[model samples]
Target: MAYYIGTNGLAAFSVINYLHAFMFLAFLGIGSTIQPMISYYYGARKPEMIKSTIRISELTVLSLGALFILIGFFGADFLVSIFGVASDTIADMAATGIHLFFLGYVFMGINFIYMTYYQSIGYIKPSVGITVFRGFILLILMLLILPYFFGINGIWLSLPVAESIVAVVLMVYARKGVMEQGTFERRF
Candidate 1:
């Protein structure tokens, strides 16, 4: 699509993707930190501890997500500039893509939190399902489908759409378990 859009689009995408890589790594770090802690608490049969851990992790992740949204929304030009994107066209594309793409961060952390939560609690299938949907299935579908309709803006919108959908599904699936007392057993 970028090739169709020309060199400026490709350059903008490259810069945005590079910055996205850093943001993704931070998301992974949050997941890594919570996974082990959740597993340990669950193993100890400490439901309250697990609840507390999740609360803290969710707060932290949401805060980070908010920060990311702010930066992506307001600091788009600065972010592009850091990569030395001097061309106005390229910079505008990068900044626009950044603004649109980072909307995913608002819900991205929820997907990560639940995916890691399910994995830590020994619910492998749901964990894997969430991971696959977020990382591949929904992403590929949106990447393929969205761009066909909206062109370049659709490409920018894909990740946010996929992430938001998965997050909603995960939340709905986990809702029953969340309200139940005792062990966080699998519902489906």
Candidate 2:
């Protein structure tokens, strides 16, 4: 979107995209470390252990999300500088994007935990469905919608909006098990 709006040059855009991909992988690595600890423990009927693991995941995600938002808000230029973004307007747009992008992470923590819970119970289809909606569908929507409204900023804002919706949907789906018994075996 930045490239489309002419705020970022091709080379700078490519570098920034690479950095984003690297950060995504880093986040996945960190998440992978904790997900199995909760999933396997919960699957084995260790309910108390699962609760403790959830607390740990919450704290870790909160800390990381806060730090990321702070850096993205305050140091956006420093990051774009690394990609050699020379235009002031482009730098400002990148900074705006950084700050707005963090909102998605806050909602993502909730969605991720819920998705992991579903996955832990062997409800792989629902879990994958949620991911498809949250990932590709959201991306496609942003690609199609944001450019018309907010231009580059719209692209940045689309993420949190999509994530917020997905989280709400997941939460609503979760409530279907409220009248049932047990964790994974609860029927809707």
- Highest lDDT against the true fold, candidate: 1
- For candidate 2, report its TM-score: 0.78
lDDT of 2 by residue, 106-142 (tens): 6676566656766765677777777888888986787
Residue 163 in model 2: shift from native, Å? 2.1
Alpha carbon lDDT at 160, candidate 2: 74
Candidate 2 local accuracy as lDDT? 0.66
User: In model 2, what lDDT does residue 126 have?
Assistant: 71
- In angstroms, give how far residue 164 of model 2 lies from its true place: 2.4
> Please, what are the lDDT tens digits per residue for candidate 1 over residues 12-105?
8899889888888888899899899889988888888777877787788789889998999899999999988779989999999999999888
Cα lDDT for residue 69, candidate 1? 89
Query: Please, what's the RMSD in Å of model 2?
Result: 3.3
Q: What is the C-alpha RMSD of each candidate to the true structure, in Å?
A: 1.6, 3.3
Model 2, residue pairs in steric clash? none
